[model samples]
Target: MHLLIAWCGFVGAWLLFAGPIYQAATELEEEGFERDAFSAQIDTVEVPERPSPWWWLLPPVGYVLQRRRQTEYRRRIMAVMTQDQLERMVAFANTATGWLFVAGGAFFIALKETWELAEVYELSVLLFVLAVVVMFALCALHTIVRLRGTHQMLARSGTARNRDSMTDEPPATSDA
Candidate 1:
């Protein structure tokens, strides 16, 4: 019964992921978005004009390729963001990572291999504690970074408001 439940969850996850992947691939084939996303995702080898019926999977293959691009894209995005943004993201990731580890442990325990854990209680305790510490540290960092960002934004807005108040309002123009 446990195995059946796991299989069902796996299938459900595949279906959940398939819809978006299919839509993205279809859009890529349709040339809806920029050509680069399509090209980046697609296999480098060019397809022949009269390919076999088995070639129907080319776009699906491209979908897999597109998914692979996410890591590099995220790195680029992180590089360009302000310090505040980076801190918030890191904090979020820290907390999320802790939870994911917990979830992974839960999943492992639920599966057949959990019997092995009975003898390794120390390892489990150590890992769980480490995850919790990292999560808490991230939470503290998040608070500090958020407070700084808020102060910076408030200062900029206050100056802008002062300058605007100092300037005379433009006279309204009537359309002919």
Candidate 2:
């Protein structure tokens, strides 16, 4: 999923912004505009004096925010846990949840030219929003399940006063 989002987002950015610039420049040249002079003027523009690539920061920013949110949410769900178990849950949630963004972004870019620009934009926005909502819902569900399991494990351990009470014991008992 992360790969999908990254690949799509990169392609979308290139198509939506870079493609238009090239297209417009090509159009101008074809219409007998002073192509060489215009190219020279653009080339003379100082890159350092221009604005930075602030937009590039968005993906990581979004990823960080989403990861943080998922971590906090999982923490809430797995409220009853040892420190190590909680940390593992947080790590899993952070890595897994972040991939959805990448996948959705890739899907957005792939469909950009297949639809109108407005439609593409709307679809991309909707996809991202849906990704976030779904991730949240899934995370919440996972947390609930994990917490319930933990509760059951603790309850069983607490009530096991004799070897006869081990009827529900399983072969594996890892916290995960």
Q: Write down the worst ten-residue block by lDDT for model 2.
A: 20-29
Per-residue error for 37 in candidate 2, Å, reads 80
Error of 1 at 149 (Å): 1.6
RMSD of each: 18.3, 24.5
- For candidate 1, lDDT tens digit of each residue in 40-124? 4344433333434454478776555555455556555555555765665565556556545554543443332322232234347
TM-score of 2: 0.25
lDDT for predicted candidate 1 compared with the true structure? 0.50
| C-alpha TM-score for every candidate | 0.27, 0.25
Error of 1 at 19 (Å): 33
Per-model CA lDDT versus the true structure: 0.50, 0.50
Q: What is the lDDT of residue 83 in candidate 2?
A: 67
